[model samples]
Target: MSFEILFLVIYFVAMAGIGVWAMKRGKQDAEGFLLGGRSLGPGVTALRLQSSSMSGYMFIGAGSMGYTQGYFSMWYALGDLGGGILNLSVLGRRMRKLSQILGSITSIEYLEHRYPSKWIRLIAAPVALFCMFFYVLAQFIAGGRGLEMVSGVSFPVALAIAIGVIVLYTFLGGYLAVAYTDFVQAIIMVVGMVWILVATLMAVGGFTKGNEAVGEINPNLLTMWGADLGYQGQWGVILGALLVFSIGYMGWPHVVVSHMAMKKPSVARTAGVYSLIFNLLFIPGPYLVGMFALILLPNLANPETAIFEVADAVLPTFAVGIVMAAIMAAIMSTADALLLQAGTIASQDIYARFINRKMNDAQMVWVSRITVLALAIIGYAIAAFDPPAVAAVVIFSTTVLGSAFVPSYICAVWWKKANAVGAISSMIAGTLVSVLWQVSGAPDATGIDPMVTGILASTAAMIIGSLASQKSHPVPEHIGRALDETAKIGPIPKKMLIDQDALLASQAEMAGRHE
Candidate 1:
């Protein structure tokens, strides 16, 4: 067999083996399947979170942005350099402690407990699922495109193959499998990008020659402000792009869930440092490689394929396969996390909580598997319909999640008066504004990112709704105590620790006492 095919076969087999191993090793409960029993270590947690956060956007979508917008695209990298650090510092340890204290296996469940409102769970779960579906769809599209380019297969067949593998591993092993495989993928993605970047620079006679070549085509390609595309030069678009990668990292349930799953809350402290280093190494390579592609393959039609084309042209066959697999790794790492998140939301939040509250561990696992498969099929169908560019879909979905959840999430942690009314109103307003902004033509119409609109609207709603409902819906004393305890930088008292059953009983007892 050809080297590319051989390498891919090995990679796929290795991934499958990990899935089988995880299925055997991991716990069988819903918490285990969805969050790996909250036992992931620092390295694995950091890499997995980084891999999922970066996604195929770094390889394909970001590269395309570099090729199209030149140095302007570096704004994304600049914004993302410390995203993981910011995320962990702001919400990681506290969220982890709080999730366990409240018996929250999913982010939606956490929101429900934090706000003490069924309405919050009801609205938040659906909105999260909606945003995540689009995110997963984008990853599916990236997978299809990468496989079609490397394997010489039809997009549909490649898409099916991608979905099938992702579903199998995610269904069988769940988060543990996803996390371990993401560790491997994270290494591959970074190594491949760094290798490609160094080789491409060497081939083109270093930075000076590279810049000269690009300068010959159009100096505009090398500019900071970039080509004038109506709103491209505007501060809003630039700041929006920055915010989407920086602060927006906090709102992603898939990424945020990582904070809830680490072996210990202290893992976030170390993991944050590791993730920052990984991002620093991994983020810039794709953009630089894309810049190199401008000098090497100027006439290439689809700039998204710049990385793949460069790999094929510059590297040996075996190396090419490895790089291609890394590209696939980027896609799968994100796809698996998004798939798992969607499945967890559906099975845990929707199925067990709303559909049938009596689901046992075994039944929940099976339901989660089925839900993952179903979501994969739906995402595959959406991908097949020729969606927007990978970066666009990713950014749009990130913004939707950020606007809808970030305000509520921040308030849940810091604001004692953030009640169900404020949380629900913020979610509804953010989601509605983001959707309407997109439907109205996004930045082209307003020269500001849709995320900005959604965030502003959501923030306003939170303030107004909370004040208006303060008397009617005061913060629960138990939730307030839990929040204060989690906010402290130490272990929760053993006496205060409780499992799901005990948590429910305590809540019931508290209600009785209050009544």
Candidate 2:
């Protein structure tokens, strides 16, 4: 008990230390603070990107899934192992190049710049905030529940403690702080996962023995059909599980911000390699740990805490502290990024774009900090009053965010015909379909995941809407040029990346100019 408490205290101090270090580095200007002056090293960028997207999903949700559904949970892990690198390889360079061309500091700003639509920012910003808020709430729930169990405190107090620590550090440091701290937390998570997995394998007499034991308990646990063959013929469910993490990262505003924060467009390639290596090492450990626990600790009350319980059973008291701290660290790392991106979009995308366009650096920072506080309050209220399972909230939020923006984001640099009408149509249709599909319980009924349906709806909207409205809403000349540059093979000349016209183009009229 004392060890867990001590490690928790130590972890908080370390995060604060990183925050203070970031503050002292003197990148307090709005641009520097928001995007780390677009100067992240490849390693930091890779890990921060992965860590932000990985979140409590891996620590809590993935384990819970493995423990409950058995081998089917590996489908998510397989997709996740490549999601980060896939995102970087496809969008990293293009987004970095395009965002710099348009002077976009936020992902919402990047969309508006690419599609040349004020409505895109107006619509996308709110949807992003709405989705990301739920995401942060999931992290809060995961952390709060963990703390509650470890500290024997009331849920409200434990939640307050978790959110309080995360909020304090976030308030102190800006983007760099979030990135560096996630980088550090990613390292801790990898080490702890590897340590715990090895311990589990040893305890169960090896992977083969462990699986045999699980099969003896329930033969279905060893199959890809999920425990009891519940999803025996549900290919749609299986596909959704795979696609959720794979392509979802490309569309998430919070995760994609890492692209815009790269030091240069060329950093994307190196970052991709780093991402894949990290993913390969860390992505499957939690699920495997959870699956093996079907034999070792078969009676856990909450499957979400499978890793924690397994650690407590297998590891020494000190190692148990480190292991739980790693899970909490993952929760906090992801929460920090979500808060930073949500705050960035709220202050820069919505506020500056519409409400107060002339704010200075200090004012932007102040507004952002306040916005972070507001989001934390909103998330706390939602989570404290009616918290759902971490996995459910994460999947719904991921589906909405991914569906709402995936097609538009991909088309921003890739499709020359992508215009304002199409982007707006895509965003609205995607979000509407995603929400309706989930609410209607279509996934269980029809076996089609909201993510698949949402992406399909959004992509079709982007294609059909842009084509139908081409004469009235052709892509702006400057944005087309930006897209051309982004599509090129190698490092683009700096002069070509950012031009005055691209920077100052009026969002209201850029797409409508040709008409």
Candidate 3:
């Protein structure tokens, strides 16, 4: 077998080994299987979060974009960094706390609880399912493309191998296995990226030579500015991407699931900071590799394959094999997480809540595992058949979450007047506006991001709806209790720790206080 084929086989075996090992460790119950028994520490959480966030897009698409667009692609890293910083400082703690308060092991549950809207929950269920499935589809597609690129195999053959490896580990081991494996993959990704960058740079005689090479071909490609970039090449695009990406962190079911696995709010808080540190490496990797490719190989048949072409040109056979494995690792790390989140939401939110809430923990665990396989198969089929607009797919999902939930979440955290009517109105309006904006081709026409438009409209709906329904219902005391539990800084006050019994007791105490 060629080195590439050999590496592919080894990568598949190693991923399967992780699944088998995690299963042997007895992650049998729902909590154990789904959230790693709620025991992930700062380091594990940080690495897992970073790897999952980068997904296939950072490894493949961003690299391609960087190579094609030059320094314009670096703006993506800056945007992600800004988002990470804001999420840690502003939204991270609140989300962790609210997840606990609502007993929300899933993003759908969190949205439902925050809004107290049945319609919101109902609508969000299918949206989460579709959104995550599509996200997973992208991963599968990228994995297939990456494999086919390196190995010169048929796309279907490569996709099947990639999908099989991911499904075997994810279905058997669940989130615990995924997180641990993601950490391993994260290290591999960092090493692979740095190794390739260094080798590529040395071959080109450093940044100065690299820039001259690119400038000799196309002068604009050597600089931060570009012809088609418009405001996108400017600081506004950077800041907008950062702001949009950062605010949407709470919306991604996979990322939010990481927070739910934390044993305590403090753990999530610490992990938030740690997440940023690891992300520093991943966020910049594409820029370095992409920019380097631009400088080295100024012309290509397809810009998206720039990384692979560069690897083929500069790296030895053995090194190319390693980098190919690293790319596969990135795709698997992300695909498993996406698959897990989709399965969890499908089982917990849709199946368990509406279909059958009485599912035992063991039964639920089995269902979730089954859902993992089902979702992965769906992802694979889509990957095999469908081609999508990659950036649009990501932005569409983010916009769905942002417009539908951000207003309600913000109000739930900060505004006492936010009620169910407001929450429901915001979601319906937000989702519609976003969908319409996307369908209307507004993003292409006005150069305004669809997310910004939908969010603005949704925010207005939430505020107006809340004010109009002010007399309907006041903020529940449980929301305040949830907030206190999340913040984890106040005294172990009476309002916190609100189980069913504690809720009754708090109500009685409040009644007495009124008397």
The digit string of per-residue lDDT tens for model 3 on 1-515 reads 67877986776667667666666675477775555524767777677657666777776677776776677666556667777775544354455456555666566677677667677678777766776776777777777777778767887887887778778757554433543466676677777777787788887888788777767766666555552446443443444355456665555665443333333444544666677777776677666676677666767656656777777778998888888877777777777767777767777787788888897778777877888778777766666765563444665676677677777777766676777888888877878887798789876676666677777877899899988987775667777665555444334443332211221222343464447
Candidate 3 lDDT score relative to the true structure: 0.67
Residue 303 accuracy (lDDT) in model 2: 92
| 254-303 per-residue lDDT for model 1 (tens digits) | 54443333334455455666778777877888888888798888898788
TM-score of predicted structure 2: 0.86
Candidate 3 clash total?
2
Which portions of model 3 miss their true places by more than 4 Å?
Answer: 14-45, 101-103, 173-180, 222-227, 232-240, 254-271, 361-374, 377-381, 480-515
In candidate 3, which residue pairs clash? 83-246, 97-486
Better-scoring candidate (TM-score), 2 or 3: 2
Score each candidate by Cα lDDT: 0.76, 0.78, 0.67
lDDT of 2 by residue, 4-86 (tens): 88887876677667666767665477775555524667777677666656788787888888898888888888877657656
- Top candidate by TM-score: 2
Alpha-carbon RMSD to native, per candidate: 5.7, 5.6, 5.5
The global Cα lDDT (0 to 1) of model 2 is 0.78
Q: Which is superior by lDDT, 1 or 2?
A: 2
